[model samples]
Target: MMNFEMPQFALAAPEIWLGVMVCVVLVADLFDRSGEARFAFWLTQLSLLAGVWLAFYTHWGDSGQTTFNGMVVSDSLAALLKAASAALAALTLAYSRDYLRDRGLLKGEFYLLALIATLGMFVMASASSLLVLYIGLELLSLSLYAMVALDRDNRVGSEAAMKYFILGALASGMLLYGMSMIYGATGSLLIGEIMLAASGGENALLLAFGMTFALVGVAFKFGAAPFHMWVPDVYQGAPTAVTAFLGSAPKIAALALFLRLLAEGLGDLQAQWQVMAIILAVGSLAAGNLFALVQTNFKRMLAYSTVSHIGFLFLGLVAGSEEGYSAALFYAISYGIMAAGAFGMIILLSHKGFEAEQIEDLNGLNDRHSGYALVMLLLMFSMTGIPGTVGFYAKWLVLQALVEAGLVWLAVLAVLFAVIGAFYYLRVLKAVYFERVENPQPLVSSRGPRVVVAANGALILLLGLFPDTLIALCRAAFGL
Candidate 1:
């Protein structure tokens, strides 16, 4: 007789709940003849809220738990990142509501796709097996590809979708190949087993070669430089609503992917990945800052700005310690909040038939709506790493980690690039306060988006002033 035990499906309650809700909302939207997608929107928001609660409720234990034959894990890190991903997804939808409605792009598909993608992020956060991680990643990527092309009328959107799909497929293939190599070398697909195998040093050259390809895939997902050919074009061509979602929540998922595959599974190969991380960091900082300086498109400028921030995030990873991982997590969440607010500002100022894509679109913004101008001012200051903003502390933590690791020279180089990045952010402030527009239109947006954007700006300064709470949480997640 053979004995078998059932996997603990309760460990993945959040993902399971969200998956069920995706179906429920999809079916509910079919009955909504009003065309406003109100049913789908509210149901999706309810689902996310429930998902967050479930994630915390189910994963609040002190130690990590692996189930489904070690294919999924429930841990402090997964709990925190999963909750953050859900909250950020909700924020993205709140900011996107009016923008989509104005352009007649408000449909159930938008909400449905967002929920599905978020569920994918949740899965990625908890995956303990390489195969499970890849499945989650593909789910997220496919939803995003469709979301980018949601506006079927726009040729640019379709083009961006095609480019994203092709490049994304190539990256996925590389990642799969790398995973196969690692599996062949280690004779296992579970991350814990891979870590054990890597520590033995029996297949050093093969592991290193596999890691190279894996890193390429991770870099592409992060929109990091040398693999970031798709970022600017996608950001510029996609609808602002979609851009807002793309630039925010998926980042936390990317951070999860990096931590799980590189920091956790391949820690023994640090010497190899560290060198590669340095190269990526330097290239990203230089390319991102330099290119952003000359860009006239606000969305494209932020795309490069994202790349530069990724450079700083990489600095933390290079430390290869618990503190370094914690700092990177802190930076990832902070940047996600900042990015949401920055893009939300663009959506807030826009109305029917006038996409606020250009940098000069904000001319005389202070004269028109001082409140919104002040909000944008706070966001720009945060992005510039100004004192009394979260970005400052986020950067500070990364630099501190690098210095602690005795990489003082890299820290100094990062500071230089950060200084260069400040100029473009200041230019945005100048456009808001100093530049004059012929006739500035009144800012028109719903109360929900307005309130969310205001809260988003306030949170940045609040987190900066007292970052210890989030820092402690990050450290706790890593059991440091």
Candidate 2:
């Protein structure tokens, strides 16, 4: 008789548990007779906490691990990104509850979709094969498509969902086609095997062509310009709560995708992919900043701001060094936190029948709520890369990595665009502090969101004041 043993599922405990809880939440929602949103909310919070706990428990003090026939991985980077995704998800739900309840859209579906999406993020973070990565991406993508249309009665929401679905499908095709080409050239489905196959430069032309298509797909998913048409519309139309979730958690997972695909699998073809990344980065910076300057809608403006930040994140990746990768990862985490806080503030100011999405909505906010205005200041300052904020450190690290890579001209261009970007950020500050109030309604928010937002802002400043630990953690992800 042949001896047989079961695969060790413990390596993916975080993902497994998250998936189980997602099903639990979905089923439990059906039996919820009380019809209270709080039940679902508390359950969602517990699930996210459990995810974080599992992620930390499995990877703490462990260099790295691979299991399930190398389809999954448990490493410092995966652990950190998974934990970040869970925390961001929990905070997003907290910031969303009041807004959704006010609009009568606070159903269990929102929390269920968010958690399922977060589970997909964990899968992407730990993916060790192209097939596994694509599966995770589709899971997250499909969840988001539905969430964008969650407010089924809103025409704008329906339109945004249609556009997102169509565009997302096209991008998925591009990614799939590119993966097919890479598989044909490398003759392997495993990333490690692909790395070894491509290292020999056996099919350089095929690899380059494949990388170009793959890069385009990555750019679209990252919301880089030229392919960033979906961002503004989606952000503007989706409920602010959904927008908050979309803008934050998925970014960490996207970064993981970039590292796993471009950095680890195609490291041998760096020169080819680097050029494509640079083009995407420069275009994103230029278009994101220039277009954001013309937007009156706050969510649209932040959408464009997201594009520019992705440019900075790309710079670190194009540099192709351990320091560069860590810097990019660090930037992704910082941006996620800031995005949550920025959108959370919008939700806080909004009340029943008011969206608070216009830049004018913030007019004279300082006169009414000085404390909230101060928090906004820190978030804006961080986005503008001003000193004494985590945003500054994030940009600084990317520039440092670029300079080290001898891309001084690119670094200079980035700084100049950053200057332009700062104008829009400062424009937001002017609305808060300098302009007079246009609406007489008071800013209403619940204690939960307020407390979370405060902590989010405090953490940004705290990380800015002392980012060594974060930097060290990021570096440790790469064993650098």
Candidate 3:
């Protein structure tokens, strides 16, 4: 019911800013056709920065305000998640700049695609109606499918593109069908109205079926178990920089959208979805961590690790409380930064013409470059949930929330899996500090990228040292 020219400036500011940015970047690309493409690239970064600011500024004082005829909203949780998405996207752009340029992918259009995708994620986070959620999901999903094949010449990249598109289409179909069923049951597509119908105890069977189908769609989008078959292949085959962006930024946004749709809007159905999430947690943890144990390719291993970490995030969600939600949000934000750094290291270490795809490549790393090896060590420990690292705290919060939810058995399982997870994480450390490879050159980074890497590592230490402030910020944002 909303038009493009609607007077919903307060609600539309983030999308409006991002839309203008897409146009500006495309037009600039026509003028800056120099082979280096550095100017256009930096310009795109600046524009994303503007979009980030617009997200915060427009939503600063608003909470629970449905705008544009019930399409978008500025709620306590939505605002926090949107800011997290922007932060993740901004970091992804900063860390991957050098990598993108090195791979001959220094295109302004790439940034445009990222911004548009990011905008869609925020809209999903703030969606009040099912129609808006589907539109936002597609906008984000379609952009990612194209971005996966950014390296047109790489056959693996093209293969990943096809797989992602075909699978994504199936997910969309399942989701839309579920939405139709829910609409038929409730006679409304607005999430608020559907909640009312569900509460009225009308069409209970239809509601359960619709919820199951919707769970499948969310699982597909989130790379959860059984639906996660495409992720490892996509990560392994895409350009490394694109993989970094895919792993960190888009995933963060998708989690936010999941919370918005499943938790906030469908809160009354917690018993239902919490069970589904627990199953997802167990499956993802088993598949991702165990599969990662045998993987030799470094990026693919990290891809599996990413899936296990998503499982842990779901652990917090199963608690079904405000503290659990906040903890999950914190974990999502911290994990995202760690992911960027881990992949950035891959990009940083690879010299031109080398893919840097093996765990063996990190051996004798300390002998070659003590500083870079140490950074890798820090990242590995954090991912493994070692103390004195943010990863530990993130895992601690989720476990604590699970215990509070009276799910001691699940917590015990988490502890056991964390132990299993430790082994793989240690392999990376063992390769770096203990073993030997024919590392011929020092792990050198350009000054700009070195700064980015150091900043990322410092954030891990800073948050690990004193997470009280950040946790307090999350509390404030969530209106706890």
Report model 2's TM-score to 2 decimal places: 0.97
Cα displacement (Å) at residue 438, model 1: 3.3
Give the number of the best model, judged by TM-score. 1
Candidate 3 C-alpha lDDT tens digits along 377-436: 889889988888889888988899889889999989988988999999899889889997
lDDT (10s digit) by residue, model 2, range 1-480 = 966656679889999998898888888888887666566778889999889888878875565567877888778888888888898888788898888988989899889988889989999998989999999999899999999999999999999999999999999899888998999999988898999999988888888888888888888888988899999999899999999999999988889888898899999999888988999889999999999999999999999999999988998997899989999999999999899999999999999998889998899999888889999999999999998999999999999999999999999999999999999999999999999855645666778888988998999999999999988988888888
What TM-score goes with each of the models? 0.98, 0.97, 0.96
Local lDDT at 132 for model 1: 91
Sliding window of 10 residues with minimal summed lDDT for model 1: 56-65
The parts of candidate 1 lying over 4 Å away from their true place are: none
Question: For candidate 3, what is the TM-score?
Answer: 0.96
Segments of candidate 2 deviating more than 4 angstroms: 1-5, 438-440
lDDT of 1 at 185: 84
Between 1 and 3, whose lDDT is larger?
A: 1
Inter-residue clash pairs, candidate 1: none
